[model samples]
Target: MEILESKEQKLFARNLICVGIDKCENGDFCGRIWEPYDDQPFKFTGINEMVIHMDDLYDEWNYPQRALNERSFLRTHEMARTNIIRDDGFVEKIDRLQKMRGEIGTFIVQVKFRQHATWQGVVVWAEENKRGNFRSAMELVHLIDHAINKGLLIK
Candidate 1:
């Protein structure tokens, strides 16, 4: 994770924003890494084209039978409510991270890219340095901003 730390240090040097993150009940400060795209095409793309309905969204995040080695918990939305909406700094912190990532869509892409690169422990750097060959992050931000302006809100 040294490379990730170094990147965060450079970001701090440039924007004075530290990469300090709070422990999330489910995932990132605002939501799961996929939460932003939960109501979008990306969700289906990741889940073998399964359309997530409202009923499925409301399902509990409980464990299976509450075994001795496992523990039950709240639903995804409930966790989001507690860890994101209930956290006063969640929105700002998420926005800042998005900015650090260059944009929300860019952030999503980077997350997936990391996932594909390392399979797990996404914080780990890839072996090959395919730097400066990716698509423009600002272009994606513009598209996302346009969609948001057109009354986009959680499908």
Candidate 2:
């Protein structure tokens, strides 16, 4: 994968949602997720939590507002990706990307498909320009963790 070292390099295809991963103070992965049309990034703490949140978001998006069971997904689908309505004045995509890259262990993620109760996507280690494919959400988290550890070692 190409390293997005310049401002002109678009993170992914315009359609795919791009997620930025940063190492938190306690060594947990902090996620900054950006949908296509939305300028504000949705922040999550751990990788596992982030995965679950994304799944919830997806479910809520595809289905009605009614909650299934006790877990309630945010009704953010209407505001995400779809450009029918615009509340925000301008897009801050570049700022978010730059912030992610400034972190200790930066990763750019683009989830392509969700099937069999898990995620399948590609992740890029920003500092090293390394790319990896994940078969499942667990695998995705493991890949990010491994990259963070490897980055620490390299430094």
Candidate 3:
């Protein structure tokens, strides 16, 4: 496990994002991405599309679960009552790690710092057991893209 130096840093663990690549025929990942609160993982066909989804998750995870639920209160009473969702199970699944890994490729992204509206963190290419640090969201994408295209280390 990675060690971070600040009190707020511990919170990053729950917000980690997992990407499981089901297809990479065109050199871009095509698979499902999971966030801590999602009842189900989301499917995407390309890196650009996946990044968009991840960005949304990044925004949502920045808030406390209670704050997220309170935001739901802004919806109409019926909608709010019906839309209550708990991420406890989702959190457990990710904590176990790679139970959601895909057949082709898998990445566990830990976005430790969110400054200048971008991410700075480490990504683990789980299949090859390789790790790399990224200074921005784009860097993370490129790191994964490069690994997929150049070929992962053969086990």
Candidate 4:
């Protein structure tokens, strides 16, 4: 329920990445979001950046029946396959985000919820004024790098 500035959202949009999970026949496997810990702000991370297990967090909300409809699902999957730079950029940014987090404070990351019936797409959310700043984009990238290196994204 947090309203982020268009600038921040744009930065986030540039930073966000989505990946496709083929195993999900009905729905799609989007990317992930991480916060330092519970009660902390949420940040978006791309699909390639983390190896997520669909079973771990996959649920009714992420894979709703409406998202499974033939047309919408196909479009979502197609988008995932075609978007390459967005995917690669996500990986690169993650590396930078994590590194910055280490220098600033202790934190945990989690998946941000987009909406029901959006296939694998995820929306970034944060506590009001609690979200990271433009200067922290590098740190956000670093956090992603660490998650990838640690295999935290792997399911």
Question: Order the candidates by lDDT, highest first — what do you get?
Answer: 3, 2, 4, 1
lDDT tens digits, residue span 86-147, model 1 = 33444544444434231222222221121221211122111111111122323322322333
- How does each model score on TM-score? 0.19, 0.58, 0.68, 0.19
| Model 1 TM | 0.19
Give the alpha carbon lDDT tens digit for every residue of 1-155 in model 2: 22222232234533344557655647677867765445677887877677766665554454222223332376433334333223353245434553454255566666666666566767666667666777777887777676666543222
> Of models 1 and 2, which has the larger lDDT?
2
Which stretch of 10 consecutive residues in model 1 shows the poorest summed lDDT?
9-18
Lowest-lDDT window of 10 residues in candidate 3? Answer: 2-11
User: Could you say which candidate leads in TM-score?
Assistant: 3
* lDDT tens per residue, model 3, 1-155: 22111221122366677788888766567898876555588999988898777765655454222222223345733222212123445546556555568778788888777666567777777766667778777888777776676653222
2 against 3, candidate with superior TM-score: 3
Judged by whole-model lDDT over C-alpha atoms, candidate 4 comes out at 0.29
* lDDT by residue (tens digit), candidate 4, 1-155: 22222223212322233221122112222233332121232232433333332212233223222324324334434222222223344544554444332221222232333234222322222211123222222333343333334423222
Colliding residue pairs in candidate 1: none
Q: Give me the candidate number with maximum lDDT.
A: 3
Please list the Cα RMSD from the true structure of every candidate, rounded to 1 decimal place. 18.1, 7.0, 8.0, 16.1
